[model samples]
Every structure is written in structure tokens, then in C-alpha cells.
Target: MEKKHMLQIEGLTKAYGNKIVLDNLNLTVEQGDIYGFLGPNGSGKTTTIRAVLGLVNYQKGNVILNGFDIKKDFKKSIQKVGAVVETPRFFENYSGYWNLKVMADFYDHVPRKRIDEVLEIVGMEKRAKEKVKTYSLGMKQRLGIARALIHSPELVILDEPTNGLDPQGMKEVREMIIQLSIEQNITFFVSTHLLSEVEVLCNKVCILKRGQKIEEGVVKKLLNKDYEVLDIYTPSVKKAMDCLIRDNRVISINPFSEGFKIEVQQGYADKIVKILVEDNVPVRYVIPRNQSLEDYFIEQTKGGEHIA
Candidate 1:
């Protein structure tokens, strides 16, 4: 089957008088993709999302979703797209189930059973009767996601869904996202500043800086380094270093706390260990230390901070 484009942005530019919020940005989100839109705070992530949803007007560019041009047919373009931007707000006094029912009323074809189905999809079925005021931040975030899914959208967009949650909450949200993507085959466009979470959750990513795209590609390809680096731990550091230094496959070796770090050809780690053990050096363990998404982001942005 051929892959389809779920969302496409071409020359998307938004400016406020003298300040430009988005500068000729172009992005393509493929079907079934968990695409991460990453950047520091004030990096035009929200503005781009708003433009895609037709909530904000752009000076120049086209926003096409599911093959419908947003400018020419806003309703048709957004019919199958659901989004929760920034922080999701709910009726504080209403029950979770009630809140979802109200949202379902807006759609004419949404069956009442969809409310229950969405609650189950988000793992909120058991607590569906609980009032919003009594829920924790994480639970509220999940509920927000459930509401977004109530319409059975083909594409779901979330803006900083894990913004203020605890570590465990963040983990729960990430797991939920992964589950939904696999089980339902829904495409997600998530905007977040959390680089670590994006590294694990998203298969594709686009990084923005100050209002322009700096990098965009598959996560693994973007994080790939020129050579593989490994941390070798053993009591006989001197002996192992001496042995590896003689091998042509070992590019370089640097002293580390436990043993040493070696840059070698990708498949040469096994040989290094074999040489070390043959020379009476005990091997504790070997850990591959690849360049991380955070490391690449920092290098591209040049001293930019605020991302977790």
C-alpha cells in the first residue's frame, strides 16, 4: 500500500507587525506517523499548529490536511482532525463522562457509545464518573485525550500534553500514545519541548528554532553519529586499552571513570572484547553510547536551553 500524507504545510509564514512567528516552514506528516514537533519555548510550535487547524491566519502559505486545502475548505480540511492545544480545559464541576457527552453533542454522527469507547481507549472508563476537580494533572491529561478521540479523528494533535506532570505521569501519557498509535492506527502530531520523551515516543521529528526549521528526519537517522562509541568497563583498563590501540578497527580510545571509552567500527566491539579476554583482561560489561537526541538538539541550537 502507498503511504498517504496526513498533513502538509508549504511556505507557512505568520508574522506580527515586525516580528515573524513562523518563517516559510514546510512539513509533511505521513499516515500512521507519530510526528514530534520539537522546539524550545516560543519556537512557533503553537503558531504552526494553530495555522494548521485554521484557528490563526497566516500571511503566506498553504495548510493542507487529508488532501483538503484549509484555506479553500476549512471545515472539510479539519473534519477528521482533532486537537488539544496547550492546556486542555474542562468543566470543573462536571463528571468526566458528562464532559465527554457534551463534546459528543457537537458532532451529529457521533454515537453515544463512542463516549464509552473513547473513555476505554484512554483507560478512563473506571473513573468516568469522577468529577474533573478531583482528578490529578495526569488523569486530566488522559481525559483530555479521550475527548479528542471521542470524534474518531484520523489525526490527533496534542500540544505539550505532558507539560506539568510528574515523571510517572509522563511515562503513562507516553505509553498511552504508543498504544493508541498501534492499536488504532491513528496519526499523531505532538508539539512538545521535552526532547527525551520525543526521542522515545516519536518515530519522526522536526526541530524548530526561533521560528524556522533546523532539522527534520527519522529519529534514528538524525541521532546517528559518524562512528559508534562504546564504554568498556573492566579492572584491567591499561591492558584492554593497550590491546585495542593495536587494532586497526578501533578508531580512538579515551580514558573514562570505570575503564575507558572507545570509538570503533560499528561491528568491531566483539573483537575488542575477544582481544581483551585473550590477554588476561576480565570484561565487566560493554555499553554502546550513541549520540542522543538531546545532544544533537543542543549542538544545532547552540547553547539553547529550557527543554527537559
Candidate 2:
């Protein structure tokens, strides 16, 4: 039997001053799944989060959490959700443990050990006693996560979780989020503009353009192996591309720092080499180009008509 869904949004619509931010949006996130939501600026990523969390009232559709309607019982609908929409507000002078304790007290019946467990889950148990002022930005972000998890929420929503971190900090948070999904069976729904971050962390994603979903699917299939990039560099770009300029298979050869960038038809490496050698153009290197989530994201959002 399939597990019960953690979140369900059907035909969700929200507008601001006659500006339609979300139009008949629909989505579902199951437990143990990390859904990456990507879109450009002003694409309603924040609006979607607000609607799901009940911070903003909407005119149409339903936002349900574990079958409980958000409109009818706000308490029940939010019980399983823990989200960090922006930077978490915390008392700077207090230690991490103290801050968590203060928040946990608001929700009666929270266990004593829950605070420590959440700190440990985010790898902050050792530093829990340290003053919040001394914590790094990454540490603060993790604390926000710990605070979110203090209630044992089934779904954790993070927006730009790694916004200003250095490389190591980004990796730290990324690994922690992934570990949570694997070890504790936590479900993550993250909204981010960083393509590589989403690609590395999320298994599925829903892309929005001007508040409308343009593509949604498993990351692996959405990127389709068939779209892999092929990088062809030649020492003599002008000479090498002379034979294939007018050919139907070759798109365009661009001059680059190392050599010339040759965009060829998909899976046409064999033909590219054969033509190059036949025309006496010295082929220096041919390798698969590493593509980030940004490439696919740009292709999906701005590749065609803009929808508002």
C-alpha cells in the first residue's frame, strides 16, 4: 500500500492587487521525497510557499495536509509542516539550546529530549551551548532547521537554504538535508534559484514561469540523458569548421579561449570526427560537457513564450 501524502495543493490560486501570482496551481508531495521548486525572480516561488503554509489567504483551490483542509482546521493542517521562509528570527545573546527551548515551550507537551535530538540531527549538539552571536551563517541556518524539526514535523520546507554560504557551508547544509531524508524519513520541499544546489539535493522538481508551472517531473528523466552536451574543441577553429559550416548536422562553431566551440547534432560525434579528419582539421579534444541544473532550468522557463 502507498503511504499517505504529506501535502496536496489542488488548483491553488492566489493574486496580489490584481496581479495573478499563482494560477490554478496543483502539486503533491509525499513523505520521504525532496521536491525542488525552481523559478526565476518574481515567478511566485515565495507566494506558493505562503499559500501552502496558510500565511496568505487565497480565493480558490484547496491546500491540504495529510487530508486535513487548511481552511477548516489550520492547526491540524500545519501540524506536520515545518518551514523556513526566510532568515529565522532568534535571540542573539542566548545559546542555541536556550533558543530552541523557548520555542518548544510554546507548543505544550513537547518532550524535554526533543530539543537535543533536533540539535544533534543538524549536527549542532556539540555547539548547542555556544552563544548564537558566535555562530557562523551556516550554523545559524542549521539552527533554523533544528527549530523547524523540534516539533517532529514530517515535511520541512526551506527557501534559499544556502543563499550566502561559502562552498564548504553549502556542502554542509546540503549533506545534512540529504541525510535527514535518508535516516529519519523526512520529506523536504525546497524552493531555490541555485540550479546546482537543486540538482544535487532534490530528486524531483516543479518548475514555474511567471506563476505558472511549465514542467514537473523526476529530475533524472526531466534532464533526459539524450540532452547531454557534447564539447568539441579544435586547435584551428576557423580551418576545422570550414568543412562543416554549411553541413546540415552542424549548428554553429563559436570561437573560444582554448579553441572553437562546435555545437553538433545530438549523438553525432562519429560524424563530426569523420568530417574533421576527412577535411584535414586537427581535432584536439572531444568530451562530454558538464551541464548544471541551470541549463535545463533556463531551457524550460525562458525557452519559449513568457506566461503571466
Candidate 3:
């Protein structure tokens, strides 16, 4: 069976006056994908989201949602989409059930039973009648998700869904997202600054930097690409460094407090060990450094913090 594309952005470019915010960015989300949209501040993550939702104007490219062109068919394109770009607003004094009831009023197809169904899906059924003010931040977040899902949207866009959450709260939201993706077959387009969350939750990721996509791939494959980083501990740090520096396979080496961090082409760790040992250098231990999503992000962004 041919896979269906839930969302597609081709050559998407956005600008504020003369400054470019999104530069020829392209991305695609397939059905049932938990796709991570990641970037430092001002990398155009928000801009791209806004463009897709038609909240902002883009200078170039096109956004297609569920085979409908957003620009040419705004209403139909957005019908299958729901989003919580930031904190969701609600009538603080109103019960959760009432809040969703009010929201369901905006659409003719959403039924009263749908509200109860969504509440159960988000694990908020027990507290569905409680006032919004009494809900914890996590509970409120779950409510926001329930609201987003009330229409049974095929794709949901969430920006920092777990922001400001405690560890338990974050875990709850994370597990909820995973469960929804598995059980409902809904596609998720999530933007988050939390690299650890993306590492565990997203099946694929797209990294943006300065309005450009610098990296995009499956999470595991990207992290396991053909590069080996090793932390070598030895008394003769200087000798080991010199020996490895001479090898053409070694990419770069930096000294740490106890040892040196070395980067080399994959499958060359054994060669590095053999070279150091043959040079009469004291061999303590060579530990394989696990490359993390954060490490990869830092490398691509060049240690740049949120820009603007």
C-alpha cells in the first residue's frame, strides 16, 4: 500500500521585512508519524508552524495539508488539523466539560458524546466536571490535548506541549502523546526545545538553524551515523594524542580533564587503540562515547543559543 502524506511544506520561505525567518525550508509528515520539529530560538520553528496554520504570511513556497493546498483552500486544508501553539486558553471558572462543550459549539459536527470520548482518551474523564482553575498544569495540558482532539483531527500540531512541566507532568504528557499516536493513528507535528523528550518520543526529526534545515532523518539512524567518538584515558595523554594525531583516520581530538575526546571515522576505534599501544603509551581504557541528540543539535547549531 502507498503511504499517504499528512502534511507537506516545499521550499517554504518566510520573512519579516528584509530579514528572512524561514529560508527555503522543506518538510513532510506521513500518516501516524510522531515528527519532531526542533530548532533553537529564532530558527523559524514557530514561523513555519504559523505559516502552515495560516497565522502568518510567507514570502515563498507552498504548504499542503492532507492533500489540500493551504493557500488555495484554507478552510478544507485546516479542517483535519488541530493545534495548541502555546498555552491553551479556557474559561477559568468553567468546568472542563463545559469548556469543551463551548468549544464544540464552534463546530457543527462535534457532538456532546465526542467531548466525553476525548476526555477519556486524555485520561481526564474523572475530573471532566472540575473547574479549569482547580486543574494542575499537567491536567490542564491534558485538557488542552483533549480539546485539540475533540474534532478527531487527523494531524495535531503542538509547540512545547510539556514546557514548564515537572518531571512527572512531563512524563505524563509524553506517554499520552505516544499512546495517542499508537492507538488513534493520528499524525503529530511537535516542536520542542527539549532534546531529551524528542530523543525518546519522536520517530523522526527535522533540525532547523537560522531559518534553514541543517539535518533531518530517523532519530536512531541519525544518532548512529558513521562516526565514532571515544574518551581515552591514559597517563601519557600527550603521547597518545600525538600518536593519534598522525593517523589520517582521526578527525579531531580534544583534551579533557582526565583524558582526551577523540573523533574518528566509524570502524577506526580498534586502529586508534592499536596505534596508541604500539607507541609504548600507557593504555588505561578507551570508552566509547555515546552521541546524544543534544550533542548532535549543538554541533549543527554551532553552539548558538536562541537567536532573537
- TM per candidate comes to 0.85, 0.84, 0.88
Report every candidate's CA lDDT: 0.90, 0.82, 0.88
Evaluate model 1: give its TM-score: 0.85
RMSD of each: 3.1, 3.7, 2.7
Clashes of 1: 0
- Positional deviation of 17 in candidate 1, in angstroms? 2.5
Best model per TM-score: 3
Better of 1 and 2 by lDDT: 1
Candidate 2: tens digits of C-alpha lDDT, residues 75-125: 988887788886666799999999999988867688989998999888899
Candidate 2 Cα outliers beyond 4 Å, as residue runs? 1-3, 106-109, 130-134, 225-228, 235-271, 303-308
Ranking the candidates on TM-score from highest down gives: 3, 1, 2
Preferred candidate (lDDT higher): 2 or 3: 3
Write model 1 residue lDDT over 1-308, tens digit each, in one string. 87899999999999999899999999999999999999999999999999999889999999999999999998888888888987888999999999999988887799999999989877899989989999888888989999999889999999999988988889888998999899889999999998898898999999999899998999989987767888999888888888788778889999877899999987776677778878889989999886889889989998666877
Q: For model 1, how big is the CA root-mean-square deviation? A: 3.1
Candidates ranked by lDDT: 1, 3, 2
Among the numbered candidates, top lDDT falls to: 1
Give the Cα error of residue 134 in candidate 1, in Å: 3.0
Clashing pairs in 3: none
